[model samples]
Target: MVDDTSLTSLPKCCLSVVIPCFNEVERIQQCIDRVLEQPVVGEV
Candidate 1:
């Protein structure tokens, strides 16, 4: 098992959110807009 000290020293990574839209033409814009509002810390 890993130790607590090692976990704390580990580096942080970015997040990637994937959405599935079948026929969300109206709500698709809003969904993408909300996600862009957040800060992207990881690679794209």
Candidate 2:
């Protein structure tokens, strides 16, 4: 799981997968520079 370390380090996350459900499609997309829903994924 990503934590404060991720922000501090500015890590590079991946989104190379195949989702089946349509409801959570937006959760993932083209992993550009910044991660897509960083705020959506609440803090631990």
Model 1 residue runs over 4 Å out of place are 1-12, 41-44
lDDT of 2 at 14: 47
After superposition on all CA atoms, how large is the RMSD of candidate 1?
4.5
Colliding pairs, model 1: none
Which ten contiguous residues of candidate 1 have the minimum total lDDT? 35-44
TM-scores for every predicted model:
0.58, 0.19
Residue-wise C-alpha lDDT for candidate 1, range 1-44, written one tens digit per residue: 99999998988765879878799998989988878777763332
Whole-structure CA lDDT of model 2: 0.46
Top of the candidates by TM-score: 1
lDDT by residue (1-37, candidate 2, tens digit) is 8788678786555444333545755643543213434
> What is the Cα-based lDDT of residue 38 in candidate 2?
51
The per-residue C-alpha lDDT of model 1 at residue 39 equals 78
